[model samples]
Target: MEIRQLRHFVAVVTEGSFTAAARAELIVQSALSTSVRNLERELGAELFDRTGRRVVLTEAGRALLPQARQLLAGAEAARQAVAQVSGLGAGRLAIGTIQTLTCVDLAGELAAFHREFPAVQVSVREAPVEELIDGLRAGELDLAFLAPDARRLPDGLAPFATWQEDLVLVTAPGHPLAAAGRTLIRDLAAEPFIDFKAGTGLETAVRRLAAHCGLERRITCDVTQIGLLVDLVRAGIGVAIVPRRIGEAAGLPCVRIRQPEPGRSIVLAGRAPRPRNPAAGALLDQLDRLDRFDRLDQLDRLD
Candidate 1:
């Protein structure tokens, strides 16, 4: 089957509908359908069960999914390999990270990378570490900056640069907790808490810390954005648990956690065999030069 046909098929499967897939692929729905039809004809199998409201893979489609993804990823990798020989004049880079990423000036890094490699199309997504892991394993992401709650990273990924961060509680000015010096985790049980949604690194850490301290927190709000979370704290809605660096950057009162401190690991990682986009490597090398990371090579740490 043609690579374009396979791409259309895969897009439809991932997006869950031909309409959405066509929109994502920037092609007419009819054209995308025609391509998938041709692919199915060549394979002599019905790839999708079109009877449902949300399109789903049929048995044959399920069988082809992994191999199809691998083939597509390999093809893209080869194309990028060739493009980089011309100094990254073409090809795309897809990087993912969590909203809590504070170790690097991500926006500034992207802007600089854009100026240096003008022709390369770049996209960055802020998502939960779990979804980022899925993207990495599926080869949809070139690289990711993740704060994994778990110590051991999932398979099919390799760690590069990593930063270990301490967790601290941030409070509004004049809040009772602000002047407490270092607060114990158990002391936060009665306080109003602002937290991120479930599955995020920050939210997960807060949950784990609370659990370890054998106390249930009084959560007042579950926010999705870091800026808004900090703003809520600034408005005295509640306090939040975040990495020490982010808490400090918020310009609010940051209190350390004592009696078994809370912490998480921030790591730059990619697909284990290596990433497809050469731009990912270039960006990592630039980050290395910036002296922001504890070299993975030196520590030989993964996860």
Candidate 2:
């Protein structure tokens, strides 16, 4: 089978639909269909069972799926090897980030990485903490920056590095409670809370902290986007608990909770013992140095 055909077949397998795969691969659906059809003909097996509005991998497809992915991975590594021999770096590295730490000096670090490894192509995807971890497990991402919560981590994944920031209760400048100092969980239990939705790192942390304090929060609204949550709080919809970085950057009034829950942390995590690309390994080393936060000032930087 042609490498192009295998690529199309793998895309279809991963996406579970020819149409979606075609859109992602930037090709016409007809072309993607023909390629998969040709691949099936070559393999003498029906890879996917066609059912109404759903594509299910047949037994044959299941058996071949891992091999297909391995083949693609090997081909990519070979390409990178050739580029390395030719005195340049070349590979596509997919990265994921949680919404919480995006406001940190992430851009500066990325720019430095790109400057040093210009030949490496980087693609970044941002999702909620749970979804980001899910994507990493599904091989959709090479690396991820995540905020730690109370949830159990996936098997084979380990936190490589961490940065800490206190959780802050925030409201708009005009809100009556904006000036409150050392707020208590019990005090805010009855007030409307603008909360992050389920499965996010912030949401998980909030749930854990509430449980520890023996309090049940009254969540009046749930928002998925961090920026939108800040706006909602600014509009006086409700108060929110968020990382101090986001609250400060938004210029919102923030107070540390009395007997507050422990601060949150950003972690660099990935599958342990997985074969990592050289460039990826290097980036991880740089991240571990915590040099990115070093220049931000000692008071703001976590140890």
Candidate 3:
């Protein structure tokens, strides 16, 4: 009838005597006897035949034995399921990212996390920064890699890490800006630009930098794909401001921005209160470890 009583009954049957089961269970013999008797009473059936010196199971006892064992096994399995999630052995993690994030190797980092926590399911979604932030705030995403304005991060979001990266001007070969070794922000004001589509962090950065220079960006073409933007620049469609790493990789002529150079702070952000995903927490821990090791190595190089 009760789990404790079933456990006591099973122990008595296994030990072949009430005295031995009581000893095995670390309980008084009378208490063990009372538990078995209560179970039998609740079930309205006799569980044991006590006529002989060696007690044996009655028909009802044999019928209940397997079911009792199953119940105990089920209880144990439930506990183990909870333990797995609590220990970060298994769960799901939904992570979001912007289109441009060259500062960290996101794929490599995810692969490392998968190796360490093979049971954790990882899902990655790539979108513009604004949409990623919206997903984070809506609880649809557990973590996000973004370029958040340091002066105005969203209300309930917190940054886990931040790094600075310069944005360079990429133009077609022999373009005036590319021919010049250095150019100011205002210098590009009148030039036609190939820029990221609206709602992108890069687009916002371009606008901010232009506003700082007291100029308006003359956007000739807007694109959502980085590769297409680079191709457009290569084809002489228009010059564009992009992350320095991207420009270098595209082999486009890159000109340095001078006098309030364009740049952005890349951030790994999550909801401020933190979600209750053990897998997400584990991934974050792995990232922190790698970041700390990198910083320590940098310090060592200075020595």
Candidate 4:
């Protein structure tokens, strides 16, 4: 039977009279009576037995009432779930970012978002540019903060926020480069360098700059994570290049590379901006604000 017929049957059973059910449903009593009759005909059983002024449930109707209620409840639940997924109430958000995003301060921001949208579940995965892009396309990540030159994204991807950050040369406190306030690219040819391993944004940036300078960096260790690289650098393993914020946070000495303009643009990319869920939109807004503040802070430092 149709869901509407089942609902009409339920209303009649609840209000104990066809006229009252129709009044409650905003339908004519005759229409409600016909709907229930049609439903009974489809089921090959009478749902109610009328006794002049009142209607009592048939044995079949008594057995079917719980099932009908369950079906209507489930339908409503499905509707609400779809609405939540469409960004109305609560949903899950997966975010991807590089390991060296020290300036972004995602930790505090995530905590705040969690507090604000307690119903929205947020998860972050750290990966290199290549892997993040792969995850984004593969539907593993809902949003991503990726460094520029992260390969051309697929047509489906859309960029919403952008910012520039300076890259710097980093080494342990007493390393040779640390002593030299600002180190040159050529001067680093002899020093054993700690490099970001394959599949990392910093590694790509370092490789690109090396190719432009036509210099083979003396990489003694290749690690995937910037945190590990920093630990190694702190132990005097070798020198490395990374975002200035990371080096500064690691408390390592950094020298700005003069050639090749050592800086990279950061961008927030995902599916279409117009169709993003409320959680995703909230995240996008926070990221844009963060980027703007970072730019202003950088300008103030320069001045």
**What is each predicted model's overall lDDT from 0 to 1?**
0.85, 0.75, 0.79, 0.74
Candidate 1, residue 17: Cα displacement in angstroms equals 5.7
Per residue, candidate 1 scores C-alpha lDDT tens digits across 60-122 of 999988888999998998889898898898888889999888777889998988898888888
Give the per-residue lDDT digits (tens) of candidate 3, residues 124-226: 7788888788767655577898876445567787666666779999999888777786798877767889989787878888878888889787778899998
The per-candidate count of clashes, in order, stands at 0, 0, 0, 0
- To one decimal, what is the Cα RMSD in angstroms of model 3 from the true structure? 20.2
| CA lDDT, candidate 1, residue 220 | 91
Model 1 scores what on Cα lDDT?
0.85
Q: Score candidate 3 by lDDT.
A: 0.79
Error of 3 at 100 (Å): 0.8
Worst 10 contiguous positions by lDDT, candidate 4: 294-303
User: Looking at candidate 4, what is the lDDT of residue 138?
Assistant: 48
The digit string of per-residue lDDT tens for model 4 on 105-199 reads 78888987787677776767777787787666644466788874644445677666556779998888987667776866776778888888776
Model 3 steric clash pairs:
none
Best by lDDT: 1
Off by over 4 Å in 4: 1-88, 148-152, 273-275, 288-303
Q: Using lDDT, rank the candidates from best to worst.
A: 1, 3, 2, 4
Per-prediction TM-score, please? 0.82, 0.78, 0.67, 0.65
The Cα error of candidate 2 at residue 151, in Å, is: 8.0
Instruction: For residue 144, give model 3's deviation from the true position in Å.
Output: 0.5
Query: Total backbone clashes of model 3?
Result: 0
